[model samples]
Target: MVGEELVGLTPEMIEASQAGMKAIGAAIAVGSTGLASAAAEMAIGSAAVGATAENKDVFGLVLLLTVIPETIVIFGLVVALLLIF
Candidate 1:
């Protein structure tokens, strides 16, 4: 009886596994993109600081460039929501 129970795959168990997988995928999507965005921002921020130091007039352009990496995180959040829902 124990062997039979262990051998059979139940519908609830299948559903639980599917839910776990979906959660994992969502976490990965959000985490990876967040990390990428952080790295991009770090690189761009340093470059922007240097550029701003060299020319005060280019501050606006540098600020725009520095903010661009934030979109990656926003896209990541969208992907994670899609996976969850």
Candidate 2:
């Protein structure tokens, strides 16, 4: 079936797949953390400035978590650029 056909790929295809996965993970981290926390902060901002500020701190932590994953996209971009030049 189609599953068997996709069981293996060439080296280039494998690398591309890895790069795509990495980019996806990075996107989720950056997009989810940044947007979710920002929205949460916005929602809570009016009720309690102090607690909302604490949520901002959590947002910062989430942003930090996003960095490592985001590096994956950077690495992919570097490799792609190198290939182009």
Candidate 3:
């Protein structure tokens, strides 16, 4: 018994640690994208409002541009899904 390794991880400990890491990874994936999407929306939304006020004709195009940032969140969701399952 004296020669036994004093410090080492058991199989269960390794599995638990891996699971926790995966959860953290998934959270980070979703959280960072959500923040990016919000930041992009803030800039685009302000510009779109200003353009609409100056000239009504560009409202439709501006609206489309504002929504483009949302796609970034979807990509993050896909990454989270891949990580989880």
Question: Model 3: which ten-residue window has the lowest total lDDT?
Answer: 1-10
Model 2: lDDT equals 0.58
* Clashing pairs in model 2, backbone N/Cα/C closer than 3 A: none
Candidate 3 lDDT over residue span 1-85, tens digit each: 5336524768798788898898899899999999999999999999999999999999989999999999999998999999889
Would you list the clashing residue pairs of candidate 1? none
In candidate 1, stretches whose alpha carbon ends up further than 4 angstroms from where it belongs are 1-7
On residues 33-80, what C-alpha lDDT tens digit does candidate 2 reach at each position? 656555655545444555446676566555454354445445555655
TM-score of each: 0.76, 0.44, 0.78
lDDT of 1 by residue, 1-85 (tens): 9768757778899788889998998898889989998899999999999999999999999899988988988898898899789
* lDDT of each candidate versus the true structure: 0.89, 0.58, 0.92
- lDDT pick, better of 1 and 3: 3
TM-score of 1: 0.76
